[model samples]
Target: MSQRPRPCRWLRRPGSDLGLRLTLAAAAAVLLLVPFTVLMLLVATAWPPLLALDAHLAATLHAGTSANPALAGVLQLWTDMFAPGPLRVLVGVVAVWLWWRGARRVALWAVVTMVAGGLLGAGLKLLLGRDRPEFLDPVSHATGYSFPSGHSLTAALGAGVLLLIFLPFVPDASPVRTQRATRWTIIAAALIVTVATGLTRVALGVHWLSDVVAGWTLGVAVIAATTAAFATWRGLPARRSPQGGSGRPPPRDMPGRT
Candidate 1:
């Protein structure tokens, strides 16, 4: 008698690869880091035992109060407005708005990333109720808490969100050359800005390094969640067409079509 065939796996589903990447990103950002951030925040807030870290850092800054204002002031230039973070987010938003144009789906997510990141950062700040450094008058002041640096969170979330937003269109299915370049270029740029903003806070003495770390973690988590949702939404079964060869299709199905 003929042997029975093995059951088919669900590996060949549409967007499966993209789904996997999304899953990986989510796990890395949320599972691995977010909880740790929460713990750090708690330590920074509840564990009066841990509160000693803040005290120590505060003392260090105080000791060096006259160290170098001119240098800090220079580094503090454009970064103070959160341009290092939100500015990049804005660039990503513009990409979606310009290239994707009327494509509501893409545009909406860019907006979602910017708004959600801000909200999450603020919410965490208030929830933790961690105070800002008393070392100097804040170049900027936020009324809420400050365990996780909002600038860092904003930067990380912006980076992650934009990366995911464009991941599906990376030209893998159709084999385009520049798609990979463009995708990577965007990712690299985002990382630079995100990291810079986080570090800026530390240099400004506005927040401790721990705050930046936590904010970065949470920001990454937010993007992961967004990516998973986007991938799931796009992963619904759809037949691939080989009619087009240059990565994207002809203008037929696009806006100006009959």
Candidate 2:
């Protein structure tokens, strides 16, 4: 008889896998649903706190737009680069490259995470039917329902997925200090990209501050869920060989296997 794979240290505790999964599920639910609820409240009643913050940001950022053409130009460039179309193209390229490198599962996860984030953002915008911020003159034009900033959502999603995918490449045998430094560097870079993308959306007056917040929250939830799922899949025991011995499965070229 083949022996079962041993559980990890944490899983060896009282609740085991069920407890870990439930914890992840609860965290994901709160991260995903709370932002959604707040968005609905904003849509249904124009929640005062959110509205006031949006107005203040718009007034502060939109001031002197005409005087700082260069700054406006740079922000607009960042906005355009992180927009849905360009982001999709970038995701596609990364997916193709990963496939070429034989990391098909990682590639698929990245693509799905990004595409799902975009679709979710679009669906929420349509359902809420909230209008873009018009409290001040928009330095850049945007046409769509604006309950959630798509650029912010996709940027966050991309940053998160990329970070997770690359994290495993860090050598486990490295000195603890080196590992810690590398991890922090990766995290900082991801945060910078995600925050910069969201800030540009608000700075341009094309999206409300609440819109960006919801986008960031939702994107993080998606990343968390995907990470949990992938971990579960990886932890599954390898199939037994026909010789009545357990062994790892033979590698195969399976696209979108995740």
Candidate 3:
């Protein structure tokens, strides 16, 4: 009789995979904190050069968009679609689906990342107490301290959560044409939504370039940190199973499974 495959030892104890998890955590921290810290300091001090650039870009985009009604309308529509509220709702639905599918860790990660990103952005905003740029003829308005754009942060968090959770299901090499096409399509779509969400906030006169940039950085950091934690929980070198390559524990080993 053939022997059953042994469970990966690393998955059972986090200490076994300490080095890899620490590396991932450190890299994520540096990427998130270094530039984000510098940006915060510059904004706090109201650095002349940074402020000038912020004002110039904000004004230029506002002017161009104001002149072209159709372009402005499009930007507005894009922003509304990816706004924090809608993104949060979408993430919530995704979390529910993941939970039902028995990928509980992934579902929890998604919720935690999204909530953490939003709270971080909101906390920083209150700390800085920054004001939104004022335009004589404003194309749009957002109420909040504007050092970090909420919409951008939410979009990035939502997109990152969905991408990481679903990516493992998409085969790297598939014989089916539709399956192969979907490989890159998901990644490209995520990028477009995240980037466009930030751009629209600036173009709409609702947020500064720095605000949008900070949001993107913070959101990505939260996603990375949470993802690393979950990866550590599940162990590295994810198991391959009939369902697909997944970080999730095998259904047979899962809690409450028969």
**TM-score winner:** 3
In candidate 1, residue 19 scores what lDDT? 59
Ranking by lDDT: 3, 2, 1
TM-score of each: 0.67, 0.78, 0.82
Off by over 4 Å in 3: 1-18, 176-181, 235-258
lDDT of 1 by residue, 6-35 (tens): 111111123537756766756765684657
lDDT of each: 0.60, 0.73, 0.79
lDDT tens digits by residue: candidate 3, 46-114: 999999999999999999999999999999999998999999999899778767755566667778889
Over all chains combined, what TM-score does candidate 1 have? 0.67
Would you give me the overall lDDT of model 3? Answer: 0.79
Give residue 200's lDDT in candidate 3 (0 to 100). Answer: 93
Alpha-carbon RMSD of each model:
9.9, 6.2, 7.1
Candidate 2 lDDT over 1-258, as tens digits, reads: 422222121112133465576477557857787766767687569778768888898768777553588988998998887777876787788778777765666676678778778888899899888888774345788899887888888888888777766665566678999999998998898898789989888888788878888888888887767655555554466689889777765433232222
Model 2, TM vs. native: 0.78
Off by over 4 Å in 1: 1-14, 37-41, 48-50, 55-66, 81-103, 136-143, 163-186, 237-258
What is the alpha-carbon lDDT of model 2 when measured against the actual structure?
0.73
